[model samples]
Target: MRLSQFFLPTLKENPAEAQIASHRLMLRAGMIRQQSAGIYTWLPLGLRVLRKVEAIVREEQNRAGVVELLMPTIQSADLWRESGRYDDYGKEMLRITDRHERELLYGPTNEEMLTDIVRTFVKSYKQLPLNLYHIQWKFRDEVRPRFGVMRGREFLMKDAYSFDLDEASARVSYNKQFLAYLRTYARLGLKAIPMKADTGPIGGDLSHEFIILAETGESQVFCDKDWLDLDVLDKAPKSAEELQSFVDWATGFYAATEEKHDPNAVPIPADRLHSARGIEVGHIFYFGEKYSKPMNATITLADGSTTPMHMGSYGVGVSRLLGAIIEASHDEAGIIWPEAVAPYHVGIITMKAGDAASDAKAQEIYAALTAKGIDVLYDDRDERAGVKFADLDLIGLPWQIIIGPRGLEKGVVEVKNRRTGQRDELSVTDALARVGA
Candidate 1:
């Protein structure tokens, strides 16, 4: 993509309303625009990053054997009534009514609806152990929605529902999602620790909130420091047994959110107990038959008896992750995106945009990199050299190739690593090789 053609309205000064670094950078970088108090409109650059994050979540969900199917942003309130949560869900649920005077709502979560669907079609134990997921928009009426997308009222979420015949099988399904979440976050270059959490309105006894440590986080968390070194993707071709082992390895450490902490319990060694603020990126709940029983989602067993199917729900705050990642990975300059979810892998800056020699050289490099299937953002704007350099750094592309008139005369270009701040003047061919063209 060419910067001259892109609609990036970057600002020189931070917005006064943005209290957090991620929120400020997001607005100043022209990644998003506030539509209302908590609603936002994602710009082209922001959408690219959002889709990249969604792709990782989808891939990990697929790897865990969860099928994807999108549910609606608006759902009938009848389903909630069936599950006996129509009034219990409180103000967080955005209740509504349609033209015909029928009740509806922008679903905050989909437990009741998913169970209703299962009971309508699935009737036998043979079809048990099915996991379905969807990446869709959700609306929760937060009284104080701040921090940009981190606590937005309307956001994208990846919610997966799992069904099983019994508790044992349901536990396996839960472990599958647990492992998937670990891989998903790791792929996005985040060290998310699974801390025991209060289920809140989700109403589940067993729940874990995957949190990424950041000083500007909303919640305080306590955990052992060693969780930083655990890698979920290291073990390939994951199975239930392998997932159980990973769970055991992770749970062996002491980790708890404020809601789950016990003052009377044996304390973790003071030095080992790392207390920090963190953002909740994902959450998993193993609420067996919680919704199924209430919604009458029953399946027939081998003995010809019918019983409620055990179920679990797993959620990843897809949009919030954009902010959480920035909180975890940004520096003073701007966001340093993980390669897997970076909007563009490289930023090609034509320092002398109108100059024939510099333009030609940058175009050549851009063509070569694009041909090699690399996503390169070509800055062909007629801006000052310093401005171009600063813009490229602010966007935080992994690499920057500066084709200045001086460098072009020497048949060399300045290659800069955004993360490391390392610069090297190399021949065009050497630069291409270094950039994997």
Candidate 2:
């Protein structure tokens, strides 16, 4: 992508309404523009990052044996009524009415709808351990939607629904998602600790919320200090027993959101407890028959007896992760994107756009990187060198090649690592070889 032709409307100053680092940087970097309170339009650069996040979520979901499908944003009110939650869901549910006066709603979640679909088609235990998932947009009309996409009214989410014949089987599905979440966050360059959490409106007997530590988080978190050092992914548990053992080890540590915490309940000594603010990026629930019982979603057992299906729901805030990643990764200058989710892998900065040598060298480097299947952002704009450097740094690509007349005279170019702020002067061939571009 050429900066000169790209629709990246980066600003020199931050927007007045942005109150946090992620929000401010997103605005100044021209990644997104607010359309309304708690709502925004993701520009091209922002969409690239959002899509990358979605891809990771999808890959992990698939690895966990969750089948992907698309679900509609608007749902029939009858489904919610059958689940006995139409009125109970409260004001956050955006209720609507069609021209014919039939009630409708923009679904905040898909519990009732999934249950309805299962009840209509699934009839026997043979279809027992099915998991269906989708990546879609959701809306919850927050009373005060603030903090950019963190607390947005409209957002993208990856939601998975699991159906089992009984509670024991449902837990296996839950464990699968548990490991999947751990793997997902690890791939995205985050150490997400699974914390005991209140299920809230989801109404589940067992629930866990994945928390990523950040100073500018929305809620206070208390956890066993040991959690920071444990990598559940490293354990690589595959069998049911192994998976359960890993989950047990992870949850055995004392950890809870403020709402679920009790001072006397924690077994950890004060010296071992770590208290910090954290962002909730994903959540999972084993709601059993919360939706199935109310909606009569049932299946026949092996003995021919009929029973409501046991169900679990898992979710990752797809769009909200953009804010969470920025919160956990950015520095004073701009967002230092983790390599796994960076918008572009390599950047070619033309030090003097009008200079023939500099421009030609940048083009060569850009072509070399792109031909190697690396996403390269070419800064070919007719702008000052300082301005281009600042913009490139602000967007925070992982690798950069600085092509200038002076460096070309030395038979070398400058290569910089964005994260470490280290620069090396090397021959153009050496630089290309270092990056394998």
Candidate 3:
């Protein structure tokens, strides 16, 4: 993408309403624009990152044996009523009425709708361990939505519903999603610690919230320091016992959100206890028959007895992750995106846009990287060098290949690492190689 042709309306100054680093940076970088109090219109640059995050979530869910299927945003009020949560869900639920005067709602979550789907079609234990997921937009009308997408009223989410014949089977589904969440965050360059958390309106006996540590995080969290170095993804657990063992090893360390924290319950030494503010990126719940039984989502056992299928719901805040990632990764300059989730792998900045040498070198580097399947943002605009550099840093591509007349005269280009702020002068061949590295 060339800055000259791209529709990036980057701001020179931060938006006054943005209270957090992520929100401010996002606005300044022209990644998103607020449509309302809690609603946003993702611009071109922002949509690229959002799509990358959604893809990672989808890949991880599929890797965990979860099938993908999209459901509607608007749901029949009858489903929530059957689940006995229509009124209990409170004001956050955006209740609406259709032209026919039938009550409906923009689903805050999909437990009731998912249960309705399963109940209508699934009839036997043979489809027992089925897990289905979808990446879609969701709305929860926050009383005072703030902090950009972090606390947005409308956002994208990846919610997976698991159906099992019994409690033991349901746990396996939960463990699968638990590991998937860990892998998902790791791929996105985040170290998410699984913390015991209240199920809240989801209503379950067991729940875990995957949180990423950040100074600007919304809530306080406590966990073992060792969690920062754990490698559960090196080799995935395959059996039920292995999965359970993985869960045991992961949860053995003390970890809890503010609402569930208990200093006295922690067995770890004070030195090993790492307390920090964290942002919730994902959540999982094993609610047994919480939705299934109430909605009569039943399956017939081999013995011919009908029983409510045990169910669990897993959620990843797809759009919210942009804010979380920025919170966890940005510096004073701008967002330093992880390689996997960066809008572009390399940015080609021509210090002198019209200069023969600099423009030629920038085009050469950009073409080379582009042909190699690297996403390169070429700043071929007739802007001052400092303005170009500032915009490049603000957008925060993983690598920046700087071309200047002087550098081209020296037969070299400067390659800079956005995250480390390290710059190196290298030949065109070497700069391209370094970016691949």
302-407 per-residue lDDT for model 3 (tens digits): 8999999999999999999999999999988899999999999999888876899788777777788888899989988888999999998999999999988888
Candidate of highest lDDT: 3
Preferred candidate (lDDT higher): 1 or 2: 2
Superposed on all Cα atoms, the candidates' RMSDs to the truth, in angstroms, are 1.6, 1.4, 1.2
Distance (Å) between predicted and true CA of 117, model 3?
1.2
Q: Could you tell me how far off, in angstroms, the CA of residue 340 lies in candidate 2 after the best superposition? A: 1.2
- Stretches of candidate 1 off by over 4 Å are 235-238, 258-269
TM-score of each: 0.96, 0.97, 0.98
Model 2: per-residue Cα lDDT over 1-437, one tens digit each = 88788898999987889899899988888889999998899999999999999999999999989999999999999999988889999999999999999999999999999888889999999987999999999999999998899999999999999999889989989989999999999999998989877789888899999999999998999998888987667786857679888888778888887887888877999988899999999999999998999899999988989999999999999999999999998888788998889899888887886999898889888888888888889999888889988988888788889999999999999999888999999998899887666
The candidate, 2 or 3, that scores higher on TM-score is 3
lDDT on C-alpha atoms for all candidate structures: 0.88, 0.90, 0.91
Q: In candidate 1, which residue pairs clash? A: none
Q: Any runs in candidate 2 off by more than 4 Å, and if so which? A: 259-265, 269-271
Model 3: colliding residue pairs: none
